[model samples]
Target: MKITISVEQPTGDFQKKLLALLADHADDIEPDATWTKERAERLYLALPTNARRIVKEAADRGGYVSADDLRSGEDSSLRGHSAAIKRAVDRGARDGWWPATLQSPVQAQGPGFGKVVGYLIPEYLVEVFQHAANKPSRDW
Candidate 1:
């Protein structure tokens, strides 16, 4: 027997908001596509000097990229891309660009041999909460 999976595409306000966010950050680094560090640097440079400074600072502080950097260029890592997308969506939602819905945190069971007694949260939101009591952080 074979099982089929159905995919639900993002639609309505979600689609429109998602598209607008993509458009606003089109120059940013994309995942799985052929984008070089040189291109990312160029895009980063194209932004306002303040934005560039923010990216540099964030990078220096051990952040893969500043929120500004992600906004200005396409990132290759799914985590980076998701974070950037979230930032954009959050911004647009705040600005009334579209009605935003609550996206429950992504979750997963911890690796174990016996009965599942523990859970692991996504890495991103780990810093926010004291424990993994809530839903897992976003994962691609």
Candidate 2:
């Protein structure tokens, strides 16, 4: 059975009991967490500078980076990198580096259909991707 538990500020006893239960099932548990550090690092390493920049931008924004802001007459970093980014993500899935069911960490989102305001990294996943990059980003 698959189980997911969300605990915040768990007590010491609760933590110990959880660990004991997990240890007992360790043999049956397969590593399937999406947005894992290793997987994120691998995928990030596989991407080109432009694609990586897009990821960093979204991550730096704490999830969503605006595409409306042109950089001194330049197009948004996400503008020309979409296809290459998609290919890189697909390759990662095919190579078994990341989970096949997981969608691209960088996603285009907006208020409604046909209106793309920016790419969102997902608040929960920003930290993982940032940790994977392991570097400071330039001003975006």
lDDT by residue for model 2 (1-140), tens: 77756565679999999979989989987756577877777777787887777787787778777766423355534455645667877898776666556778888777776656778888899999888777543321
What is the per-residue lDDT of model 1 for residues 1-140, given as tens digits with 9 covering 90 to 100? 33322224656988788668768966772423222333233333333444333334333433333333334345422233233434544554454333344231222132544323222323443332222112233322
lDDT of each: 0.37, 0.72
Evaluated at residue 87, the lDDT of candidate 1 is: 53
Candidate 1 residues lying further than 4 Å off, grouped into runs, are: 1-31, 64-140
For every model shown, the clashing-pair count is 6, 0
Candidate 2 has an lDDT of: 0.72
